[model samples]
Target: MNFIDLFAGASGMSEGFINAGFVPVSHIEMDKYACDSIRTRAVYHYLKENDKEDYYNDYLKGNISREELYEHAPKQILDSVLNIEINDKSIKSIFEKIDKRLGDKEIDLIIGGPPCQAYSILGRHQENIENDPRNKLYIQYGRFLKKYQPRAFVFENVPGLLSAQKGQHFKNLKTYFRKMGYEVYHDKLNSADYGVLQARKRIIIVGWRKDNDHGFPAIEKIKRKFTVNDCFQDLPKLKPGEALKVTPYSLNKNEYLEKYELRNGVDFVTQHIARPHNERDLNIYKTAIKKWNRERVRIKYPDLPSHLKTHKNESSFIDRFKVVDGKGVSHTVVAHIAKDGHHYIHPDIKQCRSISVREAARLQSFPDNFFFEGPRTAAFKQIGNAVPPLMASAIANKMREYLCQI
Candidate 1:
């Protein structure tokens, strides 16, 4: 299967798509940091594909940073992303490049969602949400859809798209696609259905050129409740303010931990270090955990102890500083984690700090080998914004079987 990725973040849907045997024809992204992160993954795959993975092997052993890994990158991956800026002037040039790389090859699919901030319900609470420039990004997706005329396409976004502008936004989207003459099917899917340890819900809209029996993939719900311990127990523990660029991990007896272990070299635990926290925040975390342990209750915001109740707008922050119950799946990891990480408090009573970048990625079902490229905070943002590769993979697997038969 061949496809194109638009609004492609560092990980999530595209990672699973690639793992499911789809070849990425092009990746379009606006953020430079996110582009860097995607490029790092491209380089890693290039090295591994060409039997030159020793370069990345060295980096895994603490011999190089992510930047240095590219110095030894294969020409194929670099050229794949060479010139395709997303601008009015560059759209034509990008189309021409696609023609060159994908010459005479019908694009089997086009995949991606418009930026979701403008359509997110929580984000709409802001005054500027109505006319946010990003609200119009869906038109850009339309342009590509019309140009490629792929046999199939998958569009994904937050459920807010269903209710934006009193449902007008969603109505307009359906109208636009209907005019294109494709049969569209949309549904809200939970990540937990695919074994991701986070309760993230997103709307997936799949379209087919001609109607028959095919529709969106059927994803089965996971019976096991993937908990905090299942996702984070094996990684090295860290103290507040402690940071390490590289550290060894035990070849633990867990599925994920075992997949990431390095037998000959020191496979570093990347972006797993803790950030510094103020005394007030630290004390609040300690108190929250203690309250949960003694009362078997979650310490949500607005119910904070007197010393911790500082915000005047307490009602809006009711779920703020929330400590995830250790017995079940984590709450949805949002991009807000990059700002301060207060929402995703560690469930452990002793580790009075926020979950690290690696932990957040785990909740999103990102594989341990998938290294994120950026500052620590940027890494967290990318993880929070991803679609959970495991979930995406299940969808891709079903789509693959159906499309190949066609």
Candidate 2:
């Protein structure tokens, strides 16, 4: 199958589709860096090669930055980035020429969510969706979908799209899709239920051509629950601050610490990961855990597990680390919240560090092989913003099975 990706932040959906055997034809992205990352490949090859200083000097010594080498990049890299359909006409011209390389292949799937700040819960209260400049991105996506007329489409966003303004915005979106002659099926999915160790919930809407009589196929249930330990237990252990030579494991550590130790620039997650926690947060964790432990002892009911009670007790330490029940689901793995360690943290460790990038990616069910790029901030954002790969894989598998029968 052929596809186009828009608002392709790190190509999460694209990777999922590709793993499911679909070929991505084009992608549109506003962030040059993120575009650069996705443009490279499903993983960071440059980083892997860069570590081998000898290889860089022998083969890439005078070559332009990887971002500038797209014209000469291999077919695989070009498909991921060069065929970009952009907001700028000048850029679009460059992409048209690249499209010629595809010859007569037909595009089959159009997948992506637009710039989603407007649909984010934080953006709604601080910025009005109606007036928010970013809200119109959906219109842009709609225009792209109409022009491409791909047989199938997938739109994803924060759950805020459902309850934002009591559902008025969602209502309008539904009507708009109906007007386009597409059968749209949307629902909020918990990533944990689909194999992600975290409990991220997102609104995923799949639209199919009315003639197909088939929309998104059902996703298989996760075979078993995952936990923080299951995802990160194999990695080398570190006290709050550490780094490793493995590219992915290396990127997972706080960049700032890596920068400070290695003398390079770092991004938000790296800095947060590298930096030690302040006294206030440390104290809060201690207090919270103490209060929670006391409450757990006082409770007599067996229905409520002591592990789940961590959510109810706000004393402080409980927020840092809570036992993740093997039989239950996990909390959403948000980015850069390591400072607070509230979202996902080590259940056994008492340290200030939040789960590392590798840990978070694992919780998101990203394959250990899928590498990331940019500073710590970019890495964290990409991981946090992505559709859990395992979830997408399951969905894609089901869709493939159903389509074969058709």
Candidate 3:
């Protein structure tokens, strides 16, 4: 049950596996901010597990800073994040500590995805398709497979990975793993199908050692569909530029909300701060909402109120400002939100602002108790880049069930 997480951005995949009863010996990430978030999570895990109730109480009362809590975290967990490339000599430290942390157990699982921009189909054209250096990071993953030889591994990336090079890249990827003695099952999995409200389509590759017979888990259609409303409806409404640092979540138990509840039983949520919008964008949001309500459906660009049709690039950015209908599955939450959230305008016209970091996190299926540590934009980047914890939980559950039998 011991695992190593690579390319562990904010430890989203690690969170899911750990929640499913797997133990992580180390989480390797390169970004300092992301590593801090993962380390903070480890601190929370330590506090919760070691029965340090008073420390948490002190934290809430502002008697001790978050830095003080880190002092109490186990060194093994604090060292969990190595902010360096996998090939760097720094990786030696993780190998040095693995035996001490895991004892007699071999590494059972390896989970993560490489940086995906070069493999994304949308960002490529004829000249740059094969020239992206990030495309070579798969070799780093393969290196881990050869060294650790885990019982199973999970690799995630954008769906475009399938078509990266006229299908040759995918074929070669499978062939390489097969040579490593793994039976691989690779496919595009939509997060919405696995209970995440966001319609994120990621390529998930699950591999088992040749001797194991576990096929990928069955995909079942959900009876009760989750939507933008289901995820964000309960949050307090906000106007442009308004922000609330902390607010209480209304306790409501539904299958969806249960997965997103605060695990520590904390009543308040942090990072609910909203971003300010210029007058031009606010007017556009107002028009988008007013027009959509009137039409009771999607509002085309040409039909937008004339005053809002000032942009010259109508055809290219036609529906640039989108208001997600609360009743429908949310549009994919992408890292572009870090630059500007115009692509994901709040569904509520009264708010008249872009989606906040916390709202984006909700759409991404991060648990209410989990905190992203950084600037607001950094938080958005972390959430946008993460795997939805609930969706990841489903995958880990199936993987664990099979691993136990083996």
Candidate 4:
């Protein structure tokens, strides 16, 4: 099956679909750094298929530049990543480019959702958010469905999308998709239910042609037997301001890492680096970690000593400083982590810092071999915004099964 990914942030959704044996027609994304990431991922897939993974490993080890890696990959593979924004002015050209890529093939699926910020609960608090331009990106998504008329589509977004504008936006979305000749079914799904270590809930809408008999795919829940510690146990520990781009594993393989392919037989790890923290924040982290370790209680920002308190808006967002629970699934990883790590502090007090890039990726179910392009902040933004590949692969497998029958 062939599919086109829209708003393909870091190609997480694309990775899952590819892992399920679906071929990507093209990936459309606006951010330059994200586009580069998608291209790099495409190179990885292409090299792996041709038994040239050594080239990719070299890139990870900093032995070769990204340009050199791209030089080895075919032009079509690199060109499959479209670094253009989707809007009225660009949709036509976008369609032309995708059509060229498609050639004689048809798109079996259309996957991806618009930026979720406009519909997110936090975003709704902003003034005039209803008029936010991002809210209208769905119209562009509808346009693609209308043009391609694929057999099915998967729309993924934050759960806040269900209640956006008092459910009016969702109603309009269903109506719009219906007009495009799709029968839509939706449910709120937790990533943990699909094998991701983080308990992130998202709104997943599956739509098929109105003429088809298929309904939403029944994705079964997975019982988790491991905690976030399983994801963290093998990586080398780091203090604040420390970094290790490519380092050998600190420990042997464990059940969670082996079962989920997070380790993926990679001999080395990259981006296991931590952000620098001030003495004040480190002290606060110590308090938070001590509280959680001893009493299993999260230390709220308001509970901090007067010297530790920084933000004045104490009435809300009081639990701003948080520790990643090593005993269980983590809280939702958000793009805000790029701006600061207060909400994603590491559980180990010895580190006295926020989680590293590789650690964050592990929480999101990204494999060890998957190298994120661009700087640390950009990588975090991509990871936080991505659809966890483990969950996406499950969803994609279900979609493929349903498509095959019809």
Q: By TM-score, who's the top model here?
A: 4
lDDT of each: 0.77, 0.58, 0.78, 0.92
- Clashing residue pairs in candidate 4 (N, C-alpha, C atoms within 3 angstroms): none
Worst 10 residues of 3 by lDDT: 255-264
What would the per-residue lDDT of candidate 1 be over residues 27-113, giving only the tens digit for each residue?
887777778778878887778778887887677556877768887875557556532446567778778877888878889888887
TM-score of 4: 0.99
Q: Which number leads on lDDT?
A: 4
Instruction: Give the runs in model 4 whose Cα sits over 4 Å from its true position.
Output: none
lDDT of 3 by residue, 222-308 (tens): 555667777786677877777676667654545557655623466666678788888877887887777666665655677666776
Estimate the lDDT of model 1. 0.77
- Which digits, one per residue and each the tens of the lDDT, describe model 4 over residues 329-379? 999998999988999999999888999999999999999988888889998
lDDT of 2 by residue, 1-406 (tens): 7777777877767777777887666666766656766765532443443463333222222334554444334555555564343554544464465366456765567778766656775576674467775655566666656765667678888898887668887887877876776788898877767666667788888887787747656776755534445455445555555544242232353432232122122221121232244555444434444434445321122323454442554543333444332234556655445234544434433543455666666666665544466655577777777777667766666666655564
Two-way TM-score contest, 2 vs 3, winner: 3
Which whole-number lDDT from 0 to 100 does residue 141 have in model 1? 76
Q: Give candidate 2's error at residue 177 in angstroms.
A: 2.3
User: Candidate 2's C-alpha lDDT?
Assistant: 0.58
How far off is residue 166 in model 2, in Å?
A: 2.9
